[model samples]
Target: MTLMKAVTFRDFGGPEMLQLTEVARPEPGPSDVLIRIHAAGICYHDVLSRAGKIPRDKPGQILGHEIAGEIAAVGSNVSPDRIGERVVIYQRLFCGQCPYCLAGRQDLCRNSRVLGENGGGGYAEFTCVPAQNAIQMPDGLDMTTAALAVCPIGTSVRAALGVAKIGPGDKVLVTGSGGGLGLHQIQVAKSVNAHVIAVTSSDEKVDVIKQAGADEVIISPDLKFSREVWRLTAKQGVDVVLENVVTNTFGESLRSTAQNAKVVVLGNIGTRPVEVDPGLLIVRRIRIAGSGNATYADVRRSLHLLATGAVKPFIGRVLPFPDVGQGHALMEQKAVVGRVVLSGW
Candidate 1:
């Protein structure tokens, strides 16, 4: 049995629970590819999982999803020549024969599971995933940038375009606009020529939010930004609201939307519940859709936009693999301006 260095926590608690240890290297199954992980992004979701907020992400599971690497080997069923291709992982495990997967909605597959739950994850030097999940990174896209291709970027694609159907002349609002997903979602909405209004809880992030292509930035540390949204849209409200921080902002997001507008909820970082007024939802005719993860097509679109520079990844920091605990602290404190990617294992 070959051994590889990996970061995994035997018990769920704080970032310190994540320890460096040796584990058996995973071998690819018949339809899988062995990936030599070059870089991996630290997502807020990882922090939540580490705190035991997610029941499915079991203890001892390697916790990372935003991955980029080169194929180091292949299973018997895979072509040997493809071993050297650079790729970004698709971020989910799914039964391919499911109806949703067949229709390209892999995120909605009946058997869908996050990669680290039952398989090797990107925190390690190597991981094995289905061949179809290894999306080829476009030429000139660095490993760090490609590491974010399927996550903050691809999920942005799903929220802005796939769910909200944002288009030219649309009024789009993005909450948590200073964070990793927020900055990318703003850029994705702008890529399609939408009018974007960004909201951030941190006053220090206003300029960075603006730099990420938000037409307007509102600093509301207390989640009191709906009135400002009303003022900004001239009482018309926004056509779409991308709610990345849904715990405290769900109500605000619903209030920030126009009649017939779609509100796409990407996450509730706190894992806490928020009260909602059904009457307000009814009167506004607001359609709230929950979105997470990305399909193969969404990842492909994300890569194209990234490769062409239509959307630039906001990489705030890059730490060596051993500094992953610091990355978790930064994410938990919401201290980073954008994505934190880990490499140099």
Candidate 2:
């Protein structure tokens, strides 16, 4: 039997639960491809899973969703020509029969199962994924950076383009602009010709975001941030606000958005609920949307954007697969400036 090393958690709590173990390598089904994972990107969802905040019925769970690798083998019915192709994978697997799938909203499919949560995942030497989920990585792109093409880039594509519909001359605001997702959000927003205003917690991130095409970068939650954004936009609030850290800056986001603006909430690392005043919604007629994972179409579009150099993913560091605990700790401490990538086989 072929064996591979994988990181898994027997009990959910802290990073300590992440352990390296040897497991039987999976065999691909007729429509699946076996990938030898070169790199995987760590996401907050992985931390949420380890902390049991995401909720799982099973005890042992392998965790990693943003995956990129070379095709090692193809199943019997698959085209052998695809073997050896470098690719990034879409993490969400939907049952094709679902109504959401028919509507091109596979991200919201009723029978959707996410990699690293619904079953075995990419923190391993090998993983079996549907051929449809494997997208060809552009030539010359680093595998480490391509690993991020799935989750962070794809999510930003969905939020900025699919949900918010940001376009040329649009003024966009992104909260948590120093973080992984925030950085990509800035790039995606700019790709649509929008003028991006990034909100972070520190001055160090200001330059980082500026380099990523943010027209203005503000230290978030400071009274001066809203003022700076207002001044930059000539006292008119931004057209769209991408709110990720809900607990820390939800109210600030509400204040920074213009009347009839769209605010998309993606994540809440602070773990606190956001309290909204009804008047703000009623008077401003602002739209607030909750965005989850990206659909397969969104992932495909993101890959194309990356291929064209329209979006660049900044990878902060690469950690050994077994040291996933340390990686999670780095994220918890906010020490990473961009996406933290993990390497396996």
Task: After the best TM-score superposition of candidate 1, give how far the Cα of residue 40 lies from its true spot, in angstroms.
Answer: 0.5
User: How badly does each model clash, as a count of residue pairs?
Assistant: 0, 0
- Tens digits of lDDT, candidate 1, 75-148: 99999999899999998888989889889899998787888765488899999999989989889999999999
lDDT of each: 0.91, 0.86
Q: List model 2 lDDT by residue over 1-345, tens digit each.
A: 999899888887888888889999999999999999999999988888888887563547678899999999998889999999999888888787878888989889888789988657888999998888888987988888889887899999999999999999999999888889999999998888999988888877777888888988787545246777788888889999998888867877887778899999899996768799789888889999999888878888888888898998878788999988888988888888888899853
Residue 256 in candidate 1, Cα distance off native in Å:
1.6
* Highest lDDT against the true fold, candidate: 1
TM-score of each: 0.98, 0.95
